[model samples]
Target: MPGFVGAVQIMNIGSSGVFHIGDVFQLTPISTAKTFAGAGSFNTGETLTIRNHQSATNTFDNDGIDQGNNFNL
Candidate 1:
């Protein structure tokens, strides 16, 4: 069987807000930083789904990344 991933909700409180996916979440103020702090663990060969808050559509699918590969920082 295949594993599964779900949608993520991110809110922008600042004017220069931009969303990103990373191995872990970061508290830095850098705009080019890759943070995955909110990510969870998952198994291999998993089917992951990523969606945007603005639209009710899924943006990414079957990312093929292991749960331990990266954090949602």
Candidate 2:
């Protein structure tokens, strides 16, 4: 990918389901919700930060996440 910068930065995440890192998310004109390939659970409205995106694995790193930190995709 030309001019590829880094992993995407996400913040202030809240979901009705147990949406966690690694799980792909979707944003539509209606609302936001977890899509395919999610493997974490959390209480409603539990905010989390994820790094190290692996689309093939369909997961991301949720450990030791810093809001401003970035990792390879």
Candidate 3:
């Protein structure tokens, strides 16, 4: 879809924009703490991975934080 100003199409109007970080990640630490890319390790209770927007594993199937886990621990 494109909206034109008479003859010129506008650039990305409602896009989510480029990802701030370019790294595939999964939910680590099934219990205590976790990191984005599983760079750190914790007790593994449950885990799921989502790359860009969607995931086949459907991390939401269970009750746990599946996104944005980068605390200064």
Candidate 4:
């Protein structure tokens, strides 16, 4: 479909980030982040720790609602 987008400023974008100005059929995003931290430096034998070691399990079902609906401006 016909579309127009003006000026846009984005600071940061993640691993599964998406930016759309006009129309979109389906936007299914599955994102995960993990971080480990420690107090002292690694040279001092400070062990890195992870508070949460869990994983991500995601599922999606896009039934093709807006599959094709193209139009003019």
Tell me, by lDDT, which candidate is best.
4
- Please list the residue runs of candidate 3 whose C-alpha ends up more than 4 Å from where it truly belongs after superposition: 1-12, 18-60, 69-73
| The 10-residue segment with the lowest total lDDT in model 1 | 34-43
Local error of candidate 4 at residue 22 (angstroms): 0.8
Best by TM-score: 4
lDDT of 4 by residue, 1-73 (tens): 9788889999998877877777888776655444344433233445666454564443343564433324311
- TM-score comparison, 2 vs 4, better candidate: 4
Q: Write the per-residue lDDT of candidate 2 for residues 6-72, one digit (tens) a residue.
A: 6776665554233334534562333333344543433245576654364343555567553431331
Candidate 1 TM-score versus the reference: 0.18
Question: What do the candidate models score in CA lDDT, each in turn?
Answer: 0.47, 0.43, 0.40, 0.56
**What TM-score fits each model?**
0.18, 0.16, 0.18, 0.34
User: Cα RMSDs of all predictions?
Assistant: 21.1, 19.4, 17.1, 13.2
lDDT score, candidate 1, position 28:
47
Candidate 3 is scored at a TM of: 0.18
Better of 1 and 4 by lDDT: 4
Of 1 and 2, the candidate ahead on lDDT is: 1
Task: Compose the digit string of candidate 1's lDDT tens values, residues 1-73.
Answer: 3445589876656754655555544644434333333233232466867544453434354775534524434
TM-score of 2: 0.16
Candidates by lDDT, descending order: 4, 1, 2, 3
Question: What shift in Å separates residue 30 of candidate 2 from its native position after superposition?
Answer: 31
Q: Is candidate 3 or candidate 4 better by lDDT?
A: 4
Clashes of each: 14, 2, 1, 0
